[model samples]
Every structure is written in structure tokens, then in C-alpha cells.
Target: MTKDQKDNLFLLVKSLTKSEKRQFKLYVGRLGVNQDSKFLSVFNVLDKMKVYSESLILKSTDVKKQQLANVKAHLYKQILISLKLNPSHQNIRSQIREQLDFASILYHKGLYKQSLKILDKAKELAIVNEEKNLAFEIVELEKIIEAQYITRSISNRADYLTVQAKELSELNVITSKLSNLSLQLYSIILKTGYVKNEEESKAVTKYFNDRLPKLELSKLGFREKLWLYKAHLWYSFLMQDFLNCYKYALKWVDLFYDNPKMINLNPVFFLKGNNYLLEALYFIKNKPKFINKLDEFYTVVNQSDFPKGENIEALVFLYGNFHKINQYFIDGSFEEGLLLIPQIETELIQFNNKIDAHHKMIFYYKFASLHFGAGNNQECINYLDKIISNKSLSMREDLLCFSRVLNLVAHYEAGLDYHLETLLRSTYKFLIKMNDLHEVQKEMIKFIRGLQDIYPQDIKKEFRKLLEVLKQYEDHPFERRAFLYLDIISWLESKIENKPVGQIVKNKYLEFYA
Candidate 1:
């Protein structure tokens, strides 16, 4: 028995929208001969099922045990064919590919004139849409046809095709190199997060410079510029340069706006660019600009012209809700933010397969912070435990380290002091092993550990002293990232002032703006 989630055919059936299901059924019945088709019956049985059971399938449908696999396979393929034919799936890329296929078929049939004509139009569309790779293929095909049938303007036609091919080939190579560098940097982030020390920074810098191709930015097309921005953005992020991250992220999103057509064509990149931009703003604590950028993202993605699909929908949910919750954190409205967690959790489950484990864990960390801000320390610990115990979360070592650190604070606040010594020791060991023992983390650990011996009357004085010490690092290049995670200054202020952390944060926010 296969689990419902593991069975691709069953999952595909579950993933279909009602309209898609209707279309699949209509498509099966189109031949009239397939009205009683075994594959159609198999599809119907799987569609009605919440879980996939091979036994149940055999019992419910005419598909025999031996033939069940084959029938299910056919049904899956047919449904995909139906989806491909759907108008919603027919984008410009698909249309161009279809034309290319038609042109190839016409060429094979010796219809050279019609084939060349179709190839010409398709090549133009491909170039306009930044599908240069496909454009190169069309050019290659034109060259093949032109070689066989000499045109009246053979010299000019050959020269034109040769130039187009060479230009497209060169541009494609640049795009490939930039894309490769961008993807490698992204992998580094997912594998180990930002560079932990000077050695790692040097290594990343070397890797980046080695792979980056030399080019004039002005001569690059939209796709090349997009990848270029991406490479630089990832490098800045890994180097912990928030200002550079903001600069490059701005360029990435602006490229789409400058070419509005690409925004609709490449909606995911557009959303991601804005998300990164907002993230940079969040790191710098520029709440006003963060809010504006977040608003702009929502407005653009909500437009009816934006592309719609399952993948893009998941990204919209992930990025949109993340920034929405982040706004609450910025404003220190933890109580209000708490209202969003339940709904967000529900959606998280709905998007479970689509959203990656790293992001899900990050969401848990945010929830923990929200609970901690509202003085619900035990609740905070609960969410933090989810992150700490997730052995499967291999990416974002920094997030794991911070979760444990925050867990220590939450445990102390909730009076769960019995495990404090053990947590402190384990967290310190983990940070050191990960080579992420920054000054903020070091100070935080020392202050928390020393709390055990402080006289009750002197605790407030200790908190004040620690706050003063950490204030110096609030703007430090590397150490400030710790504050980005835990906001220890505000936590200490809450203790000294005998107030809720949320109130302290809100006051600090007001002071910054003032």
C-alpha cells in the first residue's frame, strides 16, 4: 500500500482543481469509446480516494491486479495531456515551442518555405521573451534549411542568420555563467548559510569572482541582467552586507518593472526580488521602507495580469504572509501577530509539500519570537523546541543556533530553570562547533549564565549593564546580525524597565522614528 502523499498518480488527482478535473473527464469521454475506459475508471477511483490503497483500487475498479499499474500510468499521462492543452497553461513559451515543433515537422515534409516562415516568426517571439536558448535552436534550424535551398539573396540571408546565431550564442553563454554563479551561491546559502568567519568569507569571495564573467552591464539583455543581480545579491547576503543586498535586490526587481512584460512572464523572480529587498530593509530596521516595499509587492502580485499557477501561488503565500507577519514584529505588535499564527499554520499545512523544510522552520522561529514578545515564554519555548528537535533541518545552521539561544531565554522567562544550565552548555557548544560564536552571542550567553549568582536586588542593575554593552554592537557589521535574530537589547530593556518586551520594542521603534 502506497501512502497517498507518496503515490504520484493519487497526489496528482488530489492536486487538480475542480475545473481541471472536469476537463480531464471531458477529455476522456471525447472519444466516446473511452466512456467505459479502464484508465478512466482508475482515475475516478483514485480521484474519490483520500488515501491510495492498491487493494482498494483493485476492488473498486475493473482494472485487474496485474494491469493496475499500467492503467494508472495511462490515466496519469492522459491527465497531464489534458492539463497541457488547457488554456491557462498555454503561455508564450509554450506557444513558441509549439510553433518550433510545427516548423520542424514542416521542414521534414519538404515544405521549406512554410517552415522558414514559421521559424522566422517564432525566432522573433523567442528573442522578445528572452528565450534566447530557444531562439538559438530556431536559428540553427534555419541554417540547416537555408543550406539545402539557396535563396535569391543567399549571401545576405546566410550572413544575417550567422550573425543572429553568434549573438544569441554569446548572450546565452553569458546567461549560463551568471546563472551558474547565482545557483552555486544559492546552494551555499542553503547548505551552510552565510559565511561564518574570515576564512569562509574569503572562500566565497574567491568562488564568486572566479565564476563571474566579465561583461559590460549596458550590453546585457533583461535575462542576463536578472541573473547578474541575483549573483551579486547572493554574494552580498552571504557576506552579511545588508546595504549591498538592498542595492542589488532593488536592481533585480526594477529590471522587471522596466520591462513590464517580463513581470507577468516571470512572476516568481519578481516576487523573490521584492522579498529579498524587504528582507534587507527589515535587517536595517527601516520599517517605513519595508512597509512600502511590502505593499508594492502585494499590489503587483495581486494584479489580474500576473501569471497564475500552483508554484507561483505557493510563493505568493510564502513571501506575502512572511512579510505580513514580519511587519507585526517590526511594530512590536505581538498580540496582534498572534492572531495570524493559526491561519498561517493552517496554510503551512496546506502548502506542506510545496514549501521547503528550511522556510517552515524559519516560520516556527518567527512564531516563537512572537510568543516571546507577548510574554508567553512557555509558548515560545514550545515553538523553539519544534525547531531544535528538527533533526531533518539540514539547511540554515544559523537559524538552528539562534533557535537554541532563544530557547534558553524562553526557558528562563518561563521559570523552567531546571534545564537552563544544560541548555546553556549545549547552545554554547553548538555555536562554537558551528564557528558562529559572535560577540553578541558570547555576551548573551555570559549574561544569562551569570544570572544564577546575581542577587535578586542586583538583577536589574545587571540587565542595565548588559544593555549598555550590547548597544555598542547594534551597528557592528557582523555582530548586529545577532540582534536581527533575538533583539537582546530590547529583551534586556524589558527586564530593567519591568515591562513587557513588546512595550519596550514599541517604545524603541517610536524613538527611532522620532
Candidate 2:
């Protein structure tokens, strides 16, 4: 054999594996023996070579499979060079190789629709060549394309749920039930074999569990067990069971860690912060020895990547608690709590503006109390205006009334009689609007009765209107009215002689407060 012939045979032997080397020898014999005409024998040999090459490409695993298309393209180029050298092999080897190379490129580019079409062509060619394994591989690749399509669809839905959960939390309905339907849909997808295996199921399950707990999931129509899990967490928080709350909160965090993609979708840094805050509050109430753990609770909020600019509530809550701790220290040592007061007020103001009326009212009442305690009566009055102007009148009425009573007591202590009278008029207007005229009038009469003790001639006929309103409601369901009346009377009696209201009056006052 010529040196060039030996090199060509060696190249074919080196490129083809153990099985392909045997096939190549058969092809060489058929060509040399003229089993058919030279042209027909050469064409038959090239067709067998193409089958052997494609078989090797398909058998490669994922890492190697990624490079198979490039290898196939290089080999097809060589086959074209062979076809140009001898046009006799054209109709079989070169033509089939060109089509297969195009399909491989499309598959690699993620154009699965076009890739599948090209793959079908490749499968037809494999069938024609009687290569059963190559044909089966093409069929399997088609199934994979379908799976990728479904996975992308599911991932998009998960992204949407994350956005919705965040928006709902901002609305102060963190336990919103709208997430239940989505959770159910997610569960259905898991059961449909679309997730591929247990690992994927765990990935998706963890994602849903983390964010789903923050929403109103009760009316969501989930299975009994899922509802129970959610209810248990809520009840534990309500009961102030920090140990139980910590356990459930950690369960939620674990789900997110197990499936970090969840955080990528619905990042609830505030809710996570609240979980820690509640735990801190429980420790403060029940385990005072662990008060230092408050720093650890705030650490979680500081570490979260959630947008700080958007989470004003969490920031305010953190500052508020810090202020409380500062007050506790100052009161014990007779020092000033004013160092952090400006920061606390700034955060409170920002938080007040960000929330809706219902939440704003709650914040206003609390802020008013804080200012009143700090001896900033003007700030207290400003917060009082916010509370009264809040649109959720039904929710804020009782809170506003309580603040009014506190404000009047503060004004009386300061000897600001005009401010007391202004507050009295405001309280009268608020009670009329709330249709609790009898309670307001009873409180007014008791205020006048107390003034009578201080200055015997100060009791006037103007206070008679308050007594008349109370008389009209005398026969009504006065449980609430009677409690309010008794509250004012006890306050008057205590203030008149510098004596404490006894336990019975204290209980009656608490009943009215409730």
C-alpha cells in the first residue's frame, strides 16, 4: 500500500472506535473487491461511516454531549471535503451529514422548535440506515425539549407569585388567603411528573412554603394538613409562645434555604424581620435575662438583602424597640433617653406616611403616647390630629377616645385649662360622629363633678347636657355605657382627693378601655 493510503486508513481507524474500526475494514474490502461497481461500493462505505459517527455522538453524556454538535460540524466539513474529492459518494454520506449538522446547531442554540424538526429528519435518516439506537436517541431528545418548555412555564408562574405576596404584605394583610390557589396549583404541578424527580419536588416545595405562610392562606382551599401548618404558626404567634414561634419561623427559613430560588422570587425581608421581632418581644416579656438577644434579633434584619428604602416598617420597628430599651435604661438610672429620640421620631414619621389609614391610626396612637411620655405635648397633639383624621373611623374611634382621655389628663397636669376645654369639645364632636354620645356625656359629667370638688362654684348648668344624654341611654344595653360611666366617676373620685382608684375601679376602668 502507498504511504498516503496507509495514513488515510490509519486516520479512519483512529477516528472510529472499536466497533467502527471493524465496520471500516468491511467497507474497505467491499470497495477493493468490487462487490458492486467502484462508485456504488464507495458510496456504501461512506454511508456506513456516517452511521458510525452519529452513533458515537449520541452515546456521549451531558458534559460531552454539549460538545457533540461542534464535533459533528467538524466531521461534516471533512465529509464534504471527501465528497468533493469523489462525487460518487454524494447522495448518501455528504447529504445526510449536512442535514444532521444543521439540526445539532439548532439544538445547541435552544431553538428547540427548529431543532426538533431537524432531529426528525436525522431520525428518518437513521431509520433508513437501520441504526435503531440513533433513532431512539433522537426520540428521547424530543421529550427533553418538551420538559424544558414546561419547566420554564412553571418558573414564570413562581416569579409572579413572589411579586404578589410582597404587594399583599405592604397592604398590611400579610395573612392574605389569595396565595392558597397558587399553592394548590404548585402542588398539582408537582404531582404531574413535570418536576422530574424527588429533588425537584423538594426544590419547589421549599419555595412555596417560605412565602406562602405570610399570606392569608386559610380561605385558600388548601388540604387540611397545609392549613393546619399555617394555623399552628399563627396561633403560636398569638399565644406569645416564642419557642413555638421560633420553631415555625425556622421551619419557614429552612424551606427558603433548601430552595433559594424562592427568595429570588418573593423576597419578604420585613416579614422575616417581624418573625425575629416577635421572638424578641416574647423574650422581653417572659425571659428578661435574655434581653441581650435583642441585638441578635436585629442582626437578621440587617443581614437581609431586601430593599431598605422600601422596608420602612421594619426599620421603624427596630428603632422603636431600641428607643424602648434606652428608656428602660434611662428610667432605671435617672438619665436622659433623648440621645436616640430624634432618630426614633424620624423613623416613626416616615413609617406613618407609608402605611394606609388603618395602620396609620395604630401608629398615630402609639406615637402620641410616646411623645406624651417624652414631655413633647405638641408632638403628641400633632399625632392626635393624624389619629382623628384617619379614614378608618370604625377601627380608630375607640383608640382616639382613649388618647383623648390621656391628652385631657396631661393638659390638666400642665394647668392648660384652654387646651383641656379644646380637647373636651373635640371629644364631644368625635363621640357624636361615632354615635357614642352617652359615653362621652357621662365622661364630661364626671370631669365637671371633679372640677366641682376643686372649686365648689365651678360646677355649672352646661354640664347638665352631658347628664341628660346619659339618662336617655339608661335603659339601653348599657354594658359599654355603664362601664364608661363608672370609668369617669372613678377617675373623678381619685383626682378629687389625691387617692388611688381601688382594684374594683381599676378593673372597671380596664373593662371600659377594652
Candidate 3:
């Protein structure tokens, strides 16, 4: 190629937008570049176009764009030409090439179901072609997509169940639905290999040992296993099985140490950081000796550099969770919790402008929660409003929790009667679906307790009615705590009525003493 022609080609490749790049490829083909030298020039341009297109798709704001379809067509045409000239290109495996083109086309067409079907067929072809390594790659991609879908589904369902449980509580129906939902969720994670129990862990170890001879370790990526390990640790923590939490956490750390390259990938780094933070929190109550280790983990995370992406912003929120928990152990003070607000706010803005609607909702919820905890009620209300108004993001348990807390705070402090009435109605609706009488009573007591400080006479009358109903469900252990709170409220009520404060105090002491 002449220098001028080469420069022109470079500029064309560089300047073309994603759609225009596809047009450029078609234009190049029409130029009759059949000679070896001419074809070489066209191939270089196509290669550069591929790189540019891939980067655009990866970084694009609109993931649903049709840019991939054009690229897929271009790749398919090139592959067809290469196959006609020779069975395969020097660098491309014909079998892999064909499957990828098909998959890419299907993906771009917004037919993920069809795309996954093509990928499964391609996986079978890879196996038949004795391309086990390629098959593994296809498997990993399939799992990544499947796992994300499953996680989203699980989150949505959990949110629904939480809201239902709350609604049931208001109807005064005993419901253990949330606990049952949690158990079912744990079962799903266990069965999917996303989480492992002790039996499952042992079975997995034995299977790997037996299959190592046949398995290509290079192709059997470690990141998937690390994810499972981290999930197992979380499962253990949720179950309050501390030993298992410690064991699985150590296994997760070992995986990172054994393959430091895991950190080079964004997903792996996020998972690693998450697992480390979970471990640190697990040790807070039982293994206080590990506080220094937890600090070390935080230090490593703060120093580790992250490339700009949605996942990096996710890491920021995960770090926020870490810092929030660390405050609990470090000094048992709210200062550490306050310190995380600015960090979370900064990261929320970073994500708000970049990530998908789902992620934006997640960050908004976090920001709202942190603001509420920090006594920034108006800021919390603003963030909560954003989440509620986003139709694309479904309401979840976390959102309900924030809404309930915000409403209660607004009613008590700001005397926002409208918000208070809304909250009362919402909480009553939520409680109707709950079977756990204890939790229901606790929530009710909290509501009344808040009211006691502001409207003692009205709250006292309401509490008397609630306590009478709760006495019918006195089997709940938390009922005792509710009574204690009620006693405190009664004392405040008498004091508000101008009875001597000492008389109220003595009555509370006599009640406890008796």
C-alpha cells in the first residue's frame, strides 16, 4: 500500500463510528481487493475495526445497540472467504470461528435465548472436534450469563417475599415466610454449585482429585471456583456457622494467593474483596483477635488499583460495606459509619452516570440507607424517591426497609403527618403477611416507641391495645423485649401527665423487680 493510502486507511478506521465501521468493511470488500497484497491491507483494516468495535460494545452506554450485528456479518463474510481459500485462517480455528459468528449475530439481535442455544450447539461441536479447551470457554461464558440471571431472579423474589411478609404482619397473621424464603434461597444456591455445604465441598474436592488427570487445568478457570468458595463463606455466615465461615474464607484467600492473576480480572477482584470483607465481619463477634488481619485486608483493597468500569464502582460500594462494618469493631462508635457517607456518595455519583438502571437503583438504595443512618433525613428521602420512581428497577426488601425507616423518622422528628400516615398504612399492610409474630411485634413496638416521645397519650392508648393483642402470641421470645419497651413507654406517659418523674421511675423498677 502507498504511504498516502495507508494513512487514509488508518484515518478511516480511526474516525468511523461503530455503524460506520461496518459500512467501511462493506466498502472495502467492493473495492475488489482480491490480490494478496490488497487483501492484506483490507485484513489489517478489518482487524483494527474489530478491536474498535469490541471496545465500543464493551464501553457503550446502550448495550442493546445493533453494532454487534454489523460486526458479526463482517466477520462471517471474512470467515466464508477464508474457508473458500483454505479450510481455516492461520490464526482462526474454523469450527470456533463459525460458532462465534453465529453467537455474535444472535446476541446482537437481542435474542439471548437463541444466542444461548447457538452457544450450546457450538459447545457440543467443540467437544466433537476435540476442542475441550474451547468447550470450556463456552461453558464459562454460559455460566457467567446464567449466574447473573439467577442472581437477579433471586434478589427479585427475596424482595417480593419480604414485602409480603411485612404486609401479612399488618393483618395480624402469623407468618414465618421470610425465614422460609431464606431457607429456600439457600437451597437454590447450594444446588446450583454457587454455594457448597460441607458434604458438597468434600464431594467437589474428591471429584477434582479424581478428574485432574483428564482435566486441563489451564482451561478450567479458577475464577468460577473462587466464586463458589466465596458464596459458601457467605452461606456459612448467614447460617451463623462460624467455623465453616472461617474455613471457607481461608479457602477463598488461598485461591487468590495461588493464582494472583485472579486480581487482574475485575470480577475476580470484586469477589475477592467481598469475601475478605465478609470474613472480617464474621470475626467481629467471635474472633476479635483477627481485627488486625481485617485492617490488613482493607489496606490491600485501598491500595489495589481498579480499571474504570461498572464493576469497579461496585467495588466501591462493597468497600463501603466493609468500612461500615469495620466501624462496629474498631470503636463501637457511629463516627466510622458517618465517615462512609462521603465515600459512598462519591461512588454513587460515579456509578449513577455510568451503569445500568438496575445498578443505579442498587446504589441509590445504599446511599439512602447510609444517609438515613447518618441523620441526613432529607438526603435519604431524595435518594429513596429516585429508587421508587425508577420503574425499571423492581421494589426489593432493602427498599422497603429504607422506606419504613424514613417514614418513621420523618413522622417523629419533622411531624410530617402525611408521611407518618403513609408509613403507618404501609407498615400495617406489610405486617399482615408476616407469620413471625415476634418480628411483627418488634416492628410494632418500635413504631409505638418512636411515637411515645412525641405523642405520649396517643401512643400509650395505642400501645395498650397492641399489647393486649400481642399477649395472645406470648410464645414469641421477643415479646419479653416488647414488654420491656412498653414499660418504658408507660413510664414516659405518666411523666408526661405531670406525675412525679421519681414515681414513674420507681414504677418501672418495681415492674422489673416484680
State the C-alpha lDDT per candidate: 0.90, 0.46, 0.47
Q: Model 1 has how many clashing residue pairs? A: 0
Q: What is the lDDT of residue 295 in candidate 2?
A: 51
- Model 1: weakest 10-residue lDDT segment is 149-158
For candidate 2, the C-alpha RMSD (Å) to the true structure equals 26.3
User: Top model by lDDT, which number?
Assistant: 1
Candidate 3, residues 1-514: lDDT per residue as tens digits?
1243233333334433454445435545665653333333444544555233333333432323455455445544654453334321222245575776787687667666676777778877655443445665666555545544443434464454345334333222111222233344445433331222345445544533443222233443353444445555545544445567677677766666576545543334545545554544434333344554555555655664533333554655555455454443232232345566576667655454334565455556555544544446677677777765565643343344334444454345444555565666565555444222244345553655566355654755655655456555443422333332122333234434555323554454455436
What TM-score number comes out for model 2?
A: 0.38
* Worst lDDT 10-window in candidate 2: 326-335
By TM-score, the candidates rank as: 1, 3, 2
Locate the minimum summed-lDDT window of 10 residues in model 3: 170-179
List the RMSD of every prediction in angstroms.
1.9, 26.3, 18.1
- Candidate number of the best TM-score: 1
Error of 1 at 257 (Å): 1.3
Kindly list the per-residue Cα lDDT of model 2 for residues 129-245, writing each as its tens digit.
Answer: 433345555555655665575434344644543453344334323323323534454344322212323454565556555645444443321122233344444434333344665
Candidate with more favorable, higher TM-score: 1 or 2: 1
